[model samples]
Target: MSSRTLPLLFINLGGEMLYILDQRLRAQNIPTDKAKKVMNDIITTMFNKKFLEELFKPQELYSKKALRTVFDRLAHASIMRLNQASMDKLYDLMTMAFKYQVLLCPRPKDLLLVSFNHMDAIKDFVRDAPSILNQVDETYRQLIEMYTALSGGEFQLIRQTLLVFFQDMHIRVSIFLKDKVQNSNGRFVLPTSGPVPCGTQIPGMIRMFSCTGEEVRRLQFPSGGGYTGALREGSFQMFGERVIKLGTNMYSVSRPVETHMSGTAKNSAQHRPAHQQC
Candidate 1:
């Protein structure tokens, strides 16, 4: 052996652990080369033996007790020291998901419990005597320092935990067809009595005259109809109306009362009610 001490590159927990971690990473679809790398990554930093032991205890993924144990361990182990800023941000991230409990559920049927998603909402664990904790008036500062020791495994642990956290937060993409309504169970069940909103306008398709027809009809009945009828009553032999200006709004001019229709106008006027002329 050389007189110089060589740095140890790995934490030697023996052959069986190495084999099991290699198998687990491969089970997660990691390639043989990458599995070896990640297996090495999992054991070298931030992970103590107890945490790893609890996390991969050979339990089936579908087992309730197993999953509960897994969740409990995950939550416990991932408790990072949050500064006020981080704590505030985490609250904002979870507040909506916490309040309604809408996007999560308790353990259902054969599935793993979604109640684990409410890790932020379990109050008794978080509520007591934190006032004194906050009163410490602790100040945090970012210090630039060179780190000692190897920490290759920390990133993998964080990545894996974050992957699990986000995967649990998934709300399935739902396309509600006509008459679809969501039930109390957060499932798209039962019929609804409403139309889904969508959008409109064009020429020669009833839209040529009106965008929605309501505004057109409102203008027509109150203004166009009234003006046209007024001109008719004024003894005008209207041939056609032509728009003079058509920007922003329309301006039109119509042929006025004929000089020859004076007698007919007088005769028609005699049959009208006094208030109708006004």
Candidate 2:
């Protein structure tokens, strides 16, 4: 597995957690000040210099159990608390949402854009809190320095590593189902056609190059299914548009976050000792 996988996994999952928490806080009518505090505290803990230093280190990805413990700690870093059932549902939603994003990435390098989208939203969450914003900005710099220059092959490895981590996860999320992006069986439905990834043209014409690198001939064929031109590539710097929306918040007042407990998780819980159940 690529050592680069952990940062992307951690950042995107943290992003999803924030989206759900923000929506829930609003839905429950938590006071504005308190809601802001909860978000600030969690973001502060998430991007703490020491924690981030460790997180960005090249190392093996943590097992699901270990990673869940980390998020549990992060989630509780604020005064707000979640009971076991709520936390389980939150984790399922976070994991499945991110899994769908990873599965649908148009190009390996676009993963950076996804991460940037999360970072952008995180900054917005604390835009008025200069201190917290500073921490997030520092991490953003680190992300650019570390990932922007990596070759395509490196990004491919990172993408594959993430897929391996998400393998066998089939938690059903209501939002995805409603959006028609996920099937009843908990697997995502990949679209057959869409705008091609940035920096590539839609597939149809093939140009044959000669040994001297001259284009000898061009052949055009039928390319099916509503494909279109690529959108402009997203900015990779600290403050700019992240054109891709995969890692942005999906939940809002209208679209409340909800999940269905998968039979796999339910069966596993039934087998586990009561004390071990979450």
Candidate 3:
């Protein structure tokens, strides 16, 4: 925020995690065209000559004109250095770049990032019919937060982003559970009833997918709610030791009809109830 911490925060933005994030985001199939536009617009509007003039006004430590000149120099150097330093950190750098530019220039204008109207922005972004809408929303939501924080606005929760994250995770967990069921090799049993609530599954599911975070080895599900580990014939399989046998009383490894049919045929041939024997 202040001049002192600007470069350090820049280091964080441009540090090791930057490459990892870029690789993951780039590998994801989510469309980046809309997000790129948002990025470009914010950069263009926030960094233009007029905005710089408004931002850098008279300061006690430095003259307004002098401050602007210093900021221009910093801006030019920082922008060039950061851009050349790491492509992965470009967008994150831009968010802070705009903020730094404004503060150094000393302006009263607000940079609008996340707002209540963002729902419409999200709607427009989703209008293109991206298959993974939640992931896309997640990307946008995250982008907005970084930029929003740059402007010093407190972040707000977007429910849709959370919901989409959960849904996508459910699909992935379901696929894994299906494979587990298939591999169970008949020893595996699924509960016929009693499914865990929709939202409750999120925690355990997150734990399952992400174990690298803090204290991952111990996974705890709350008392009242739980997720069934498997789904069969439209019913979710609750995790348990009990297996229900609900079919016929008689169990046959091979064929039940053949056992009776062979005896019946021999008797019928001898008795020659003739009409039906053949």
Backbone clash count for every predicted candidate, in the order shown? 0, 0, 3
Candidate 2 structure lDDT = 0.84
Give the lowest summed-lDDT range of ten residues in model 2. 269-278
TM-score of 3: 0.16
Q: Candidate 2, clashing residue pairs?
A: none
By summed lDDT, the worst window of 10 consecutive residues in model 3 runs over 105-114
TM-score of each: 0.15, 0.89, 0.16
lDDT by residue (tens digit), candidate 2, 1-278: 79988988999999989988888777666667667777888899899999899999999999999999999898877666676788899999999988988888888998999998888889999999999999999999889999999999999999999998899899888888888988999999998688888888999899999999999999999887668999888888887888888888777446767733234433433343333312
lDDT by residue (tens digit), candidate 3, 76-152? 22111222223223332222322222222111211121121222233333455444344334433433444434432
- Judging by TM-score, tell me the better candidate of 2 and 3: 2
Model 1 agreement with the true structure over 165-194: per-residue lDDT tens digits:
334332221211222333333343422222
